[model samples]
Target chain A: MFSMTIIAILMVVVMFVGLYLKSSPVLQEKSFWQLLSSSEWKPMKGEFGFLPFVAGTLWVTLISILIALPVSLLTAVYITEYAKPYIKRLVFPILDILAALPSVIFGVWGVLVIVPWISQHVAPHFMDFSTGYTVFAAGIVLGVMVIPLLVSLFIEVFSSVSTDLRECSLSLGATRWQTVRKVIFRQTFSGIIAATVLAVSRAMGETIAVLMVCGCVIGIPTGILDPCYPIPALIANNYGEMLSMPMYEAALMFAALILFVVVLFFNLLSRIILYRLEKRLG
Target chain B: MRISKSKKISEEIAKVCMCLAMLIVFGFVFSVLWTIFSKGMKAMSWDMVSKLPGGGFYIGKEGGFLNAIVGSLYIVGASTLIGLLISIPVVFFLNVYLKKGSKVAYLARLAFDVLFGVPSIVYGAFGFTIMIFFGLRTSLLGGIIVITLLIIPIFIRTMDEATRNFPRDILDASFALGATRLETLKVVLRQIAPGIATATLLSVGRAIGDAASVMFTAGYTDSIPTSLSQPAATLPLAVFFQLQSPIPEVVDRAYAAALVLTVIVLALSITGRFITNRFSKNKV
Candidate 1:
């Protein structure tokens, strides 16, 4: 009975907090709107706008997903449908350990190695730009960070396709590629899309690595080679310097709300897609 | 026969490519491990582990990470234990007592989902705001609260999975023997105790590696925490500080600290896997 009451109270608290944050007068005020719309993000002057940060986040997330999704899907397909057992055993654990590496190390590596290499070589050759810290660089690093997740998810989805399906396709004189494309891809389309969305969300929420590489500039990035500030980076950069009570509270609330929504949407979507896939596959 | 030859060629190429991909992945992992080990091992002597970080910039000469190490242990230990205590019971209540398709269960699951996705930084902000408002700023207790909140969702989801995976026949057999509901739970459900413990250990792995959540809430202090109310530095915080410093020694110390943190997480993961394997074998 006590446990039930506690669960009930916790449930009520969750809804209450969610609703209050959604409907708070502080969030709805004209000043809050003005603050959110303005492009200036000076904490000392108490000017805060989320526009550039949000745009940066969207741009980086889009770029990272574009890079990660294709490579990961191809890698997954190759491993699941084409690779031998010995190769699969060797490859899968490597990906797992890569996924488990701490984000801080990634951040340090980005700062020390990736940024310099890009500045010296890649950026200069590609865009005639000599800078290391750019949206493109950060997005690439983010792609690397999220690749393991996408690979693992797609591998699971692909491997779930029945051996009988593959055998039947092969028996009909279809090539391995044809079997994968005709059978496995068609079957796991929804799961793949869900995994892509989940990967996008992970890239969006990434903080330390992006902060190290993204240069943290507060403006719309006109080119992929330009620097930009992501939402999480902005929050990490400004939280300590926020002087006004309202500004600080509002920034925290806004960052929390944005993160909450992005993460929640992907989590629910992934869960739903996986549930449907499980039901159908089982 | 022609088709088989062509198929063999393509299969061989694909296998080669897969092998190369795996090599690339391992190459990245080994590069990272080498970087950390080469720099970290040189600095991580017994004296370094036993002393505290000095106020000055000298790393090898002045002080060590004794306080941060102890504080990490204290904070992660306390928070993970508390989180497991609360979450296991809640997971049990939801999985066992609540009927399927019940409104309460639905809401409970929803709450868990939301909590799981909530950013660790937001938890840090919330804990910071609440603790400051309650005059508990920069305190170990504040850090514990924040870490506990961060781990709760993880523990709940893990324990929930473990419970759902528990065999129903065991429960039925106990009940068939005329055991009470609680007694049946103790006998049948408790048989999966090691699995549940493994889940909680995974939670600890997550908590120990977390940096952003504890950054604001913990409010780093160089000194050892003598009381729950005192502020303390964790290994992550120490690493962060060292990374930000201009001194070479300090940077090396940061690498050492990172290595320590990584080893701890690796150890936890291995132990969790061992326990899980042992549990599965026992069940079989």
Candidate 2:
């Protein structure tokens, strides 16, 4: 049993090492900074500039975080701090159902509904013609995908604020909204930050759904309407065909490594904050 | 008077905002469920589930996704079994063998937390690298191995949360009697049976729904895999691959596949709720 615990700890290191080893050829070919900063990505030509994909990932994740944060925070607050008990009970199952739906399903839905809607209605309002498959569309769908996760995590965080605090605030002439704003939000502020960080990490690494909607193009997206490729999408779309090119696998592996390290860093930061929060709350 | 009136109005406004947020979320959920059910039900048929992808299936021909259904069940079943074997002891060790607040336990929990966040795509790349190193082709076995890795952290974390809530006095009482540590561990396991059920539920949902991790590792096939070494298909991949087809019928078939996957997940979640409720009632 003790050995098993040790193995669990080592597994993280092993994964990092394995990915690094596989990606070393690409790293040796060009500097890590060069790979990240350049925009060119012709695999057959052996030019592996990852800037476009990195920028795409940031764009989609940022838009998603922007879209999800407010709605989730507000909804979670309403559920835990404002809504009646029965409402909480009814809403939770729906969230779980939404969460359980596969990413591919979300992708399919985006393809069927969002892409066409944007191409027809939203894009026409602003531009002459646009395919609905853009970072904006991916962001909207990803935002919806992350809502259940954010709301659930936020609910847990809000629940950690004791009932006594709410009562105390209310007794001091604070309205329900004021109590929530001043007491509940203030109390769970760090936890909310942690939850957001975790969600951002998730959005950054999410594949397939984003791949289906983001148009999977090669260039950096200059606008929300433009097609873009994300790192995870790049890795997923190209891995099988990458064998034909000499360093293609290595390049994809390096993209994975970058994603792994970035997400790992955020998760570690959030976990530490959450651990401290848990201990303090306890 | 003006300040207090303004405060009261602001409170009402805030309440309205929160309710609007709730409405928006509920709206999205309703739309997704409606879209999938309405679209998928139209395409759903007996042949979709019962028959294999016949010739020219992708080109709007007569065939179903039996390959993906059987392949999904095969991969998810074996992966869940393997993941449970690896995660159970580690969860038990974390909750039972280690002292509370121990540095090792803390580090292990942190590691699992990070692992839980690592994307499935990373797991796919890592698995692909290992498969290449061994000169192995993508097969059901590869899918099983990678998914086990992908889900172990989920299993451990869910079970660990349950185990952490377990009463320590129960362990001391068991030990005060004639029970050995192993026997006491069994006692602890029974106490947290609901947690185990919940863990299984979550891991199974994740494993079955996952496509990216197995995308490169599983190597999709048109026929069900008869051997561990053979490539297999899965429902999520089926939805994704079929949707890519230019043909409208094939795309509708993608909805059918999504419906199947969604139904399986919904059924699992409901069954899991029932099992957990049943187990939890037995607890003191």
Candidate 3:
């Protein structure tokens, strides 16, 4: 059993080493830094600069976080401090089930409902693009996909802010809103931070839903309305044709490695903070 | 008087703002579900489940997704079985053999956490990488391996949470009986059997619903996979592929597939609720 755990742990190392070796062929052809910086990706011309995908990934993730954070925070606050018992009973389960809804379902919903609506109603008023498949659309979909995660984690965090602290704040002439804003939020700062970090990590790697709406255009998005290709979407869309094109597999592998590292770093950051606090308490 | 009134006003304002935000969140959830249900259920007929796609199925003719239904069941079932075999032992070692907060145990958990955050599409990419090196093509085996890898962290975490709740006195009681460490584990596992069941169902929900990890590896076929080496279809992939078809009938069928997928997942969640409730009573 102990050896099995070691093997399971070694699986992570295996993934890292395997990704490096697989991607090294491409890295040798083009320096890793160049791949990170260059934006062009024409498989037919054999020019495989993956900067656009990386940038798209970052842009969508950033946008989604910006859109999701405030709503999720406030929702968490309401659920924790204000929701009626019946509402809590209803809302939490919906969020939990929503979290588990297949991403492809979200993709289907996005393609059928959001795309047409955005393209028809919202796009005509805005800019050059009238298609619903924009970076902003993808970001909004991703934000929706991640809301359950943020709300659930934040609720746990807020609930753990000791009742004594809440009482003390309210007794000192603080309103319910002020008590939450000043006392609970401050006390649960680490938890909120961890939830946000984890949510960001989750959003960065979102593929199916993003793929359905992001238009899969392999260029850096100048504006949110412009279409873009995220790293995960790039890999999913291009992997099927990998055999027909040389260096395609390596290129996709490199993109996957970057996503792996970025998400890993954030997860580690959140884990370290929470783990340290856990140790301190004991 | 003025200050108190202002403070009360702000409280009222904050309450209204939060209430609106909650409403917005619920709006998204409700809309997503409503869209799927309304659009999806329209084309969801008995034939969609009972029959297999025929020659004109892609061209908007009458047929079913039995192939994908069986294939998804096969892939998710086999991979989950494998995942459980591996995850059970590893989680047991973490909680039983190691000291609390031991560096090795912490490293194991950390490794799982990192792996958990690696997106499923990346897992597909990684799985495809190894498959190519080994001179393997897209096959059910590939999807199984990748998916099992993808869900292992989830299984480990779920089971680990359950094992953590195992009472120390249970171990002591076993020790007092001259029971060995292995014996203690058996007893400990039984106490947390409900957690094991919940974890199994939850991971099942995850494994069945995911499309990306299996996208490249599980080379799609219109027929059910007969062996590990054979290509298999999955419901999520069916929904994706069918939705992309230009034909309206095929597109509606995609919604039907989505309905099937959603129903299965929601059912698993309900089962999870029942299992947790059933087990919560037994908690020490």
Candidate 4:
């Protein structure tokens, strides 16, 4: 039995080992700081700077979380505080189905629906909007994807708030708005923060859906309307041809390593916050 | 009167804000499903699942995605089975064999959390590098290995939560009877059987829908693989490659493929719910 647990833990080590071995050459050949600081990412030209992709990743994640946060918070509060019992039952299944819907379908939807709609109606108003595939479009798609996760996590937090607290506030003549803002939100602040961290980590490493609509360009996008590649998209778009150039595969492997570390860091941070929050709540 | 009116106004504002947010999400979900079904219905046919792709399939020539459907089944089925085989024992060890709050147990739990959050694309990258180092190519075996790794965290955590819900008095009862830890495990396993089922199903839903991790590891093919050495095509990959084509027919087929994937995932999730409910009666 102990052996089984040990073997399962060893699985993570195997993945890290594979990443380390694959990315080692790139780390040695190109200085880590140069790779992190430079913007040039032409694989065929042997330039493997990843700074732009990092910027693109942070840009999209920031935009997505910004768009998603208010909506998720509101939806969660509405469900917990305002929704009737039968309404909650009706809403749960939709959320579950939405959560299970594949990202590729989201990609398809983004390409067919969001892309054209943005290009025709929304993009032309901007000064330099080039195509349908913009960081903003990808961010919106990611916002849709991340909303369910945040809402669900927030629902857990909201549901776990003690009824006694709500009653105390209400008996003191607090309005629904006042009770939620003053009591429920304050009680679940740490959990809400943790959910935000986890959701951003999710948007950061998202690949296929983001890849489909990110336009696959390698550059520091000047604006949300410009096409650009996030780190995962850079990897997904180029891994097929990475073998075509010397160290190209290793460079992409290093990109993957960077993605791994960034996501891992956020996940760990979220877990720590969640642990502390649980301790407090308990 | 002014303060009371102001509070009422604020409450109404909050209500409107939440309603708008819910409406936006509802619209998003509605449009995505409507598009897939409308397009998928047009392109879907009986032969799409019953036959393999033929010549010039890329150009909307004759053929079907039978290969991908079968290959997805094989890979997801095998990997889910293996993930269960490993996951059940690990969960049992954690809950029954180890002391509560032990470092090993904490580390194991934390490891699975990070693993669950690790992106599928990284798994693809890791799997590709492993293949290179081993002097191997993308094959069905590679897909199974990577996918098994991909879902291990999910498998472990679901079962861990389920096993955590196991009653301590039951364990104490068994041990008081002079039962060995191994025997106590059998009793506990029976207690969480439904969770084991739910975990396996949830992981299956996830494994079948994921494409990024399998993109590099499971080399695409037009036919069902005859052995572990052969590469397999998956539904998500099929949808991806087909959707990129300029042809309308191929693009429609991609929607049809997406519909297929969505249906499979929905069915699995519903099944998971039923099993979870079934076990809720036994929950301690």
Candidate 5:
């Protein structure tokens, strides 16, 4: 009972603080809105707008999801319906290991290897690509970072489809491909969509790796080859320095609030999907 | 019988595709490991392991990672202990004390789910604001508190599973022997000590590897913390900070640190699996 009370008190306190920060007068000032809407984000010149950061975040996240979803889904399908048991075991462990790898490691790898390789070999190939730290490079790295998660979710959903359905299709003289397309894929479509949304959600919130590779430019990205700055990257790059600037701190809080809403939406969507799957299966 | 040739062809194609997919996944794993090994190996000398990063070209020559290593152990250990200590009681209360459909237990489960999904960075931001309010800024204690928050949900879920799976007949038999509820729990349920220990260890693994939550709340300090209130660095943060440098040596050390961190997580995960497997077999 005592511990329960403590937890309740802590929760209330946390919730109150979060709400208070969200509604703070400084955060409500018209100047804050003006600053956020302004195109100029030169903190040195005392101008800061969040438009470019928002654009950068959307650009990287969209590209990442686009690249990751198909590859991860194909990998999931291969594992669930085609791979032998021995191969499944090997692939699953590798996926789990990849999932467990720290974001910092990915960041270091991105900077040390990926960024340099792109700068030297890949960037010049694209028109208007003056720098290697483009949205495309960061998107590819982010895609790789999120692939394991999408693959696992897809596998779980695909595997949940009953074997009897597959057998029924097969017994009808359908090919294995036909069985997958006509039976398993149709049954697991909602799950696949849920997994894809969740993957995109994860891509949006990803920080350290994206921050390292995205060039942290404040300008809007005109193309995939242009430098970008994501919201998480902005928070990470500016949070330490923002301690001395109250307005910047407010901006960081604002960015965090936006991020929180995005994450919460994804979490809600995932939970709803999980609940539906459970109810359908039960 | 007439469709056998088409079936065989499709199966063959499927097998080939499966092989290709597995090879691609394995290729990614091999590449990551190879990159770490090739870059990290150069910084893996005994002195590097024994010393911290220092002056120019002093990749790992100032002081040993003894501090971060010990801090990591201490923070994770303390958090795991606190999390298990808090969760086991909650689990027992729900399973043994509370009536079915109790609001508190239901709320507890929901809260745990929310906690599980809350991103680590949000936790960091929340912890930073709250800890600073409580005058616990940049302290090892703050780090422990943040880690405790991160692991509590995991332990509660795991222990809930463990306790729920404990045979009801054993509890009944203990009660029939004139033992009270608390006595029955202490005597009968204590037998699952290994499973509980394994859950705690798994929580430890998570706490140890968590970098984002600890980054802001437990601001990095190079020196060893003299008190729970002092700032300190862990291996994860060390890698983060080192990777920011432009120096080749520091960068190399970062990869070496990554390699070390990965090994630790892998060890803990393997041990947890072993324990869970043993327990399942024993149950059977």
Candidate 6:
């Protein structure tokens, strides 16, 4: 039993070591900073710059969090604090279905609906002759994808606020809204931050839906409407054909390593915050 | 009186905003489902499931995604079995053998949490690395290995949660009866059978829908794989590759494929809930 537990814990270390070993070829050729900061991504020319992809990832994650946070928070609040009992039952199935839907299916939906809508309606308002496959399109689709997750997490966080405090606030001449804002929000503030951090991490690593809509181009997107490629898309789109160049395989592995590390960091941070929150609340 | 009136108005505004947000969320869900169902129904055909891709399949000619269907079943089935085998033991170890709140258990849980958060793409890349080291090409075996790794954390975590909720008195009761640890494990397993079922269903749902991890490792094929060494196609990959075609028929077929995947996932979720509710009544 102890050995089994050790094996489970060792999985994380094994992943990091294996990825680093595979990525060492590229890391040996260029410093980590150079690889990240440079914008050149000519694989054939052996220049692998990750700046554009990283920037694109950040842009999509930011846009998604921006769109998802408020909607999910408000919706969760409505369901938990305002709605009738039957409403919770109604809302939960929707969240479950959305959560169960595959990313590729979401990609197909984005391609058929969101892309065209953006190309005709939203993108033209911002830029000239957009193909609708831009960071913004990916962001919007990704935003929708993350909404169920955020809403679920937010619901959990909101519910964790004790009813006694809510009663205390209400009995002190506060309205329902006032109690929610002051007592509930105050109690769950760190929990909300942790949920957003976790969602941001999720949005960062999402591939297929974002890859389909994000244009998969190599340039840095200066605006949301511009076509851009993210790191996960870059790795996914290139790795199959990367055999001809040894460094290319290593470079893609390095990209994977980057995602693994960053996601691991965020997960760790959120876990720490959540653990502290749990301890405090207990 | 003026202050009270202002507060009332503010409350009304907040409620209105919350309702609007809910409306937007529901709107998106319905639109997505409607699009997939409408497009999928248009392209649904008998050939789509019964036969493999024939000549000129990608050009909207005579071919279906039987290859992907069988391949997905093959991969997901094998991986789930392997995942269950490994996950059951680890979860038992966590909840049964170790003291509650032990540092090792906490670290293991934390590790699984991080692993769960890691994207499928990274797993693909790591799997690819392993394949290269082993001099293995893309094949069904590669896909199974990678997917098993991908889902172990999910299985362990879900079951761990269930195992943690297990009543301590049950273990004490078995111990007082002079039952061995292995014998007592049976009781606990019986207690968490619903949890195991839920975990398996959720992991299978995730593993089947995944495209990126299997993209490089599984290696799509035109026909269903007859051996572990052979490349296999998956429905998600089918949707991905078919949607990229310029032909409208092919693109419609992508929606058809998406619809198929959605139905399978929704079915799994429904049955999972049903099974949990059914079995949970027997739990202590």
Ranking by DockQ: 2, 6, 3, 4, 1, 5
| Model 4: CA > 4 A from native | B1-3
Model 6 sits at an interface RMSD, in angstroms, of 1.5
DockQ of candidate 4, scored on C-alphas against the true complex (2 decimals): 0.68
Q: Write the per-residue lDDT of candidate 3 for residues A27-137, one digit (tens) a residue.
A: 898887888898777777767887898889989998899889998999999989988999987786778688889899999888877888889888888875677898888
Residues B1-284, candidate 6, lDDT per residue (tens digit)?
Answer: 23498788889999999999999999988988998899999999989988899898888788889999999999999999999989898999889888888998889989998899899999999999999999999999999999999999999988998889899999999999999989999999999999999999989999999999999899999988989999999999999999999998888778888989999999988887778768888888
lDDT of candidate 2 over A1-282, digit per residue (tens):
788788889988998999999889999989999999998888888999999999999999999999999999999989987788889768877888878888888898899888999999899988999989999999999999999989988988888878888899888888888898898888778999999999999999899899999999888899999988999999999877988775998899999999999999999998898888777765
**Which ranges of candidate 2 are over 4 A from the true structure?**
B1-3, B276-282
Candidate 4: residue B214 Cα off by (Å): 0.8
Q: Give per-model TM-scores.
A: 0.88, 0.98, 0.96, 0.96, 0.87, 0.97
Residue-level lDDT of model 5, residues A70-99, one tens digit each, is 678778888888778987756765776777
Computed on alpha carbons, the lDDT of every model, listed in order, comes to: 0.74, 0.90, 0.87, 0.87, 0.73, 0.90
Q: Per-residue lDDT for B1-284 in model 3, tens only?
A: 23498889999998888888888888887888898899988998999999999889999988899999998999899989999999888888888888876999989888888788788988888888889888888899998988999999999988898898677887888899999988887888888889889899989999999999999899899887788889999999999999998899999999999999998999998888778877779788
Stretches of candidate 5 exceeding 4 Å from the true structure: A1-23, A31-38, A43-48, A128-131, B1-18, B52-62, B91-110, B157-202
Judged by lDDT against the true structure, how good is candidate 6?
A: 0.90
Model 3 interface RMSD, in angstroms? 1.6
Superposed model 6: Cα runs more than 4 Å off: B1-3
Q: Return the number of clashes found in candidate 1.
A: 1
Return the DockQ of model 5: 0.33
TM-score of chain B of each: 0.90, 0.96, 0.95, 0.95, 0.87, 0.96
- Model 3, runs deviating above 4 Å: A279-282, B1-3
Residue A103 lDDT (model 2) = 89
lDDT of 6 by residue, A174-236 (tens): 878888898888998898998899999999999998889899888989998888898899989
- Clash pairs for candidate 4: none
Predicted candidate 4 versus true structure: per-residue lDDT over B103-218, tens digit per residue: 89988887788889898999899988888778778899999989998998999998898888688899999999999988998888888989989888889988998889899899
